[model samples]
Target: MLPLPESLRPSAERLFADRLGLAERFASMLAEQGPERGLIGPREVERLWGRHILNCALMADAIDPSARTLADIGSGAGLPGVVLAIARPDLTVTLVETMQRRATWLEEVDAELGLGLEVVRARAEDLHGVRSFDVVTARAVAALDKLARWTFPLVADGGELLAMKGGSAAEEVDKAGKALAKLGGIDPRIEQYGVGEVEVPTTVVQVRRRAQGTRKGETRG
Candidate 1:
């Protein structure tokens, strides 16, 4: 295989050392799919490592290692979903995408990479599977409230929902608290981190489903 492009070596080395190889694979996959999906246009290939892969990886770090089943909504270009599956082979990921073509691309990537995963060509409302995942993650999808409504039900009674966001995650986290509570997830915690010269602004709106069901630090409201 060709050497990793010079531009991405720094980011790739960092991510790889962190054991986040999925980040690298997802960037390469986007480069491959650009011809067909048009999501990562030609101009994007060089920057995919830092902009896309690193951006998506921010969520993978927040996910507890204990999480088993992950449902990623609006998995366009398969952000953290595809990254998570590749990074953590032990974790089963169900990527939910409304667009048929994107889902097809995801399936193709999974098959080509031999990444064990499932892609569902369905929208949040159309999904009939109930409370079935250990974690639900949405990246740049709908607004926080809507994402809560869309993803929470897919989380099992003791699972959690995490919405990855930018800007003052504090404000957005507060705005979505009520919605989260109603869906069986507890209030969220704001996570902050940075990489290189770029400030990786991220907000994780995480709600614990329940605990019987309750893990320590997770309480029923």
Candidate 2:
């Protein structure tokens, strides 16, 4: 199994605290079974700690302290979803994946780690109007414009959509502005976490859903 690098220990220790072992076990499973199951590329095994686990864990810092529930859409290999559940056990975490095999794998990981995650096998759009969450998240799922359409509705009024993005975060936010307005997403901004703690900081595009009673397409007049 690939070992967690010594260089990243400080950051890992800080993000996970007492639950670091759970994160380690999850990484071990990813390194061992991820490639075979097509959940992750074999090349990713080498950097599983820095590139995947820690990267996801850093997002926990951006979560609202009052948040009680979160849903991770397209939680393939359980990236931020499983990682966040391990880090912040206070919040109820749900892993939503459209693929059957991936959903099954998430369920297995949830049971093995006893993380108590809700594994839902369906497209995010399918859950719209049926269920919602205090916070909704997605990583490498889709472009911001299309992603907003799929994820925004799942965010409860006054809740947030925290999308883990890459360097293009700003561009995506700019491009999704109109769609965001239509979806009642407000205060869109790019926030970075683990700036000094990690080699590469995690970029998150955060948007809050405007409260209901305000029409979707209505202007603030």
Best of the candidates, TM-score: 2
Candidate 2 per-residue lDDT, tens place, 12-114, comes to 8888899988998999999999999999999989988987899899889888899999999999999989999999999999899999999999999988999
Residue 41 displacement in candidate 1 (angstroms): 4.8
TM-score for predicted model 2 compared with the true structure: 0.95
Which regions of candidate 1 deviate over 4 angstroms?
1-25, 41-43, 128-131, 194-202, 212-221
TM-score of 1: 0.82
For each candidate in the order shown, give its overall lDDT on alpha carbons: 0.72, 0.92
True-structure RMSD, every candidate: 3.5, 2.5
